[model samples]
Target: MSKRRLMNTAVATAALAFLGACTSMAPKYERPAAPVAAAFPDAAASGVPSAPATDIDWQAYFADARLKQLIDIALKNNRDLRVAVLNIEAARATYQIRRADLFPTVNVGMNLQRQNYDVKELYTVGASVSGYELDLWGRVRSLSDVALANYLGTEEARKSVQMSLISQVAQLYYTMLGDEAALKVTRETLTTREDSFKLTKLKFDNGAASELDFRQSESLLENARASHALQTRLRAQDENALALLLGQGVPSDLPGGLELTGQGLVAELPAGVPSEVLARRPDVRQAEQQLIAANANIGAARAAFFPRITLTANGGTASTELSGLFKSGTGVWSFTPSITLPIFDAGRNQANLDVAKVNREIAVAQYEKAIQTAFREVADALAGRANLDEQARATAAATASEEARFKLADLRYRNGASSYLDVLDAQRSLYTAQLALVQVQTAQVQNRVALYKALGGGWTEPKAQ
Candidate 1:
């Protein structure tokens, strides 16, 4: 058989041996414990009954067209996502490097040496060929398996990055929408106060209202106008932030303004039991893969304790006369098989083994930590979702009540049934309520995004492009 065929057969045999050993020693992976409420019993006691988390597709979940567009733009343009793609490619190259360890390394070299000698002496010229070192103890095979796991881990990590990026984009979009809604309320408040001021002034001129009424109306109008200006500024800032997320200039114009009036409800979130749940979290899975790689390294390190066998072979021709160099009579070949045993290396192999085991232990702890953290995050996000959903509803009701109170107060003041102080109080309360509603709405959307991320949403690779 050819040397290449022999090498392949040897590698196969070694791999089978290693795999058999690995199967016997490898521990079954289990996720560490985390504190999550088994039942969110009070969740429905406060707000509109929320369904249990659902594993809905992101495309269908974020119903707003503009928001979806922004998310898509961010997925394409986010610098972080781009960096993650590069990391995946780097991991792929690293995997290739490790996979190559099991195979023989072959190289071609040429030598040209010329030396002058005494007249009675003759110069000797020689040339030959060399093959490669063969892996006989499965060291390279184990290392290659470790690298493959790490590579797969990196790919999953990239997907996790993508998911997070989408969730952030969605949240920012919702924030902009909420800002625009607030801006609208501010402008409307300003217009309403201005009209009320004009009516108060007319009443004062007709000798029916006092100068105090006109002054109070004027003050309310000024405050509302100031609020409008501040809301406009805030809206501009929010737009600038969204533009940056889209990888555009901060001053880039947004085609669609925030439109929250008809914003649809979020879909349910996904819920998974603890069994192999770490597989869903990219970071946790990455940690586990590192642990696996570290485990494999132990095998590689153990193999270092055994003897290494290397075989070298060369075939060529050498002759004093250049014409005879290619003749059969000048043919030459050498085959060398050598063994290297750790007789006295001052404990280098032992130190390496210790280091590998230590690293493996560290990886194991990290993998467990990652899994615990992921579980905590998912549970916290769900609780936030439940709380924020209730808060939004309460704020909405308060806003409606405050709006009615303001209207009634204005009517009573115009009809001389109450002092202008009541109108001022009503107007202030209405503004506060509206602002609070806006905040809670924003929170609800953002928390939804967070929950989606906890459930591993948003980072799916695009198809066809």
Candidate 2:
């Protein structure tokens, strides 16, 4: 064959070979299917609220000044949250490394060496060259895809941690409020019981009341005082907890007591749809990103079975004498194109493929479990909100009734128509009812916070896509 025709044929054969090599392994990325629940579990089908968008605007959701401040501080200063942010940065760095592997590496080095020949061989001062390979059965690219997905998953995890921190700080702050309010109630009851005890003792000394009645009043007074002391300790512990969350010393500057004036139940829980919940919840999204990464890995492991093609170049000088090292004859260059094919490794490839498949399945299960857990949490919050609302309402009504009954009993005892025990019983029942009402109010507030957390409201929305 003539030289031009032979060259043309060779070029055509090389192009076909390259194309054939490229076609053997392909992308195998399919998102795993997720199960769909009709609505949140135990939710009444007929009364189910319409789903809202999963993406909520945080600035609009929490309008309270105190709540917003606590969230901001937790985001900025919480140690765990800061660590989570660092984890995201580290993952991003890992992705960059994986991506850089796709291109050949060129390195330049200066070398000086001396060796003396025993007799037959030349003494040498020598240098050689080397570069790395990217044999694209897309191993590097597929691995990069895995790193990319992992980076994204870490970002979602950071969000999940941030949301949890914000909610926990707010929840603890509210708890501190409740403890303060409860302690105040106990102290006031202590004072009231103290005065009653003093008056009963006076009445007994003057013969207007019996010794037994006086002792009973003293007993009640001591019990209330004891409860007040316990409440004081509880309030201190909650304050310390709040301080630790804020990453500071527990300020001794807590309020002397709390007074509940307008503090009460929220008007209603802003209900949204289940679909929105999936989108808004961070743990769910984090799990899904993990699954995506695992799926990408399957492509990577599968690609490993194909032949790896690499092109390398080495250019440097070697000579027995240092002065002659760079001379034309001493400087040598070479190009090597090589392929590494797997013949057999006793099922290692198959085992890797199987492992990748199994991991994908595991990721699918984790994703499903996350969704299920999210659903359960939302359902629990909804039920708790409703039940606490009813409880507060009922408790408030009973408190009023008990207050009225105690007053009637007091009037009858003063007019000498009722026994001293009746007055004692009435006072104890009244105190218990009022205390229960306070407890219910605190519970209602906590329930609102839980519902906010359950609905995934505390998270800062990711910057617009």
Candidate 3:
């Protein structure tokens, strides 16, 4: 064959080979079975609710306007969330690089040479494709697939981070409200105790009451004062924690928040079947993406054992003088095709394949573990939902009983029908009951937040109006 005809045939052959090398050697991927129960253990037996938790936008889920504002701020400025977003960007860039490798990189070049002091300038100008791999066994494609999966995984990870941030902000905001409520109770108790202490002291001085009664009343007053101080400190700490979650200092102009008892979170969120709900979780999706990447790695490792073909080609004109570089008769072209078959590399290719298989196995295990972990979290949150509301109700009832007992005890003591110790005991009991009620209420609200998060709520934002 003539030189020109031979070059054209070779180029055509390479093009056909490139078009035919699309087979992947990776094992067929099937998602591992979820190693958990079919349904959450604490899910109600009646039926699924009208709406799944995932469908409820966080804006509508949290009734408090202040909480919605805080979540918005956290999504925008939280450092951890910011890092997650940046990671997605990095992963996308890396994927772009890998994808670029699937195509030849063409470049234009010019060279001039002078040998042995004979200033014969060989001027040349050409477009060249250097060492471009013909993906005969899908190695480059497999790597590109891996990068794409990883990029998708990072996007899911960002969603997971945002969900957690929303949950944290809501829980902490409820805690701060509970702390404020407890502080109010403590201050009220302190005031009542101070008045009681003054009355007892006057009676003791007038010989109508013993010094023991006066001392007992004074102890109650001091205990109330201590509780007030402790609650004050706790409320401040809660606010600081909330500020951190908000990614900025708590603003003074925040809209008024609902009382802890009034936080109208969706009370009866549906815990759908585990297979359905867990699949929607961003963490679980992220894990599956990672597993896909690992699977693609196996294809690349298998490809390593096959022959690799690379092509380097240049076509243009060359002349001894710069002005003749592009002349018709000065044309020159070269095509150098190289092939590398793995003869023996001390079992390195086999070892790499082994590593890839093991890594894929590890990914499978992790993916299942992610599903199991999600199952447990949702189960635990559902359990809390089933019990905390009743607990709060019982605690509130006990607090009311304690309040009435304190009133009766004080009345009896004033009528000279009972010892002052009875009144003191009743005061202590009422104060303890009040604090317990606040704690229970706080837990109840936080439990709802946890359930919402476990059900994969809060990752989605409301559409812009």
For lDDT, the strongest prediction is 3
lDDT of each: 0.69, 0.69, 0.88
Residue by residue across 191-262, what tens digits does model 3's lDDT show? 999989988998999999998899888888988888899999999999888888878998888887788888
In the predicted model 2, the residue pairs found to clash are: 51-273, 52-273
Question: What does candidate 2's lDDT look like per residue over 1-465, in tens digits?
Answer: 233443454354346344433532324655544465656653442343433323444444554555555556556677888888999999999999987766555555555554466433332332222334443566666688789989999988998887777667766766777777778778877887787788778889999999899989889988998888888998889878766776765445433332332433243545555765665688888898888888877777888888776656545565656577666566544556677899998999889888888998899899888877787777887787657767888988998998888788878877889877887887788778887887777766666666666777667663476
Candidate 3, lDDT over the whole model: 0.88
User: How does candidate 2 fare on TM-score?
Assistant: 0.80
Worst-scoring 10-residue span by lDDT in model 1: 120-129
Q: Estimate the overall C-alpha local distance difference test score of candidate 1.
A: 0.69
Question: Which residue runs does candidate 2 get wrong by more than 4 Å?
Answer: 1-36, 41-59, 109-131, 250-270, 315-332, 461-465
Locate the minimum summed-lDDT window of 10 residues in model 2: 120-129
> Number of backbone collisions per candidate, in order?
5, 2, 0
- Please state the error at residue 159 of candidate 3 in Å: 0.3
- RMSD of every candidate to native, in Å, equals 5.1, 5.9, 2.4
Task: Give TM-scores for every candidate, taking all chains together and pairing residue i with residue i.
Answer: 0.79, 0.80, 0.94
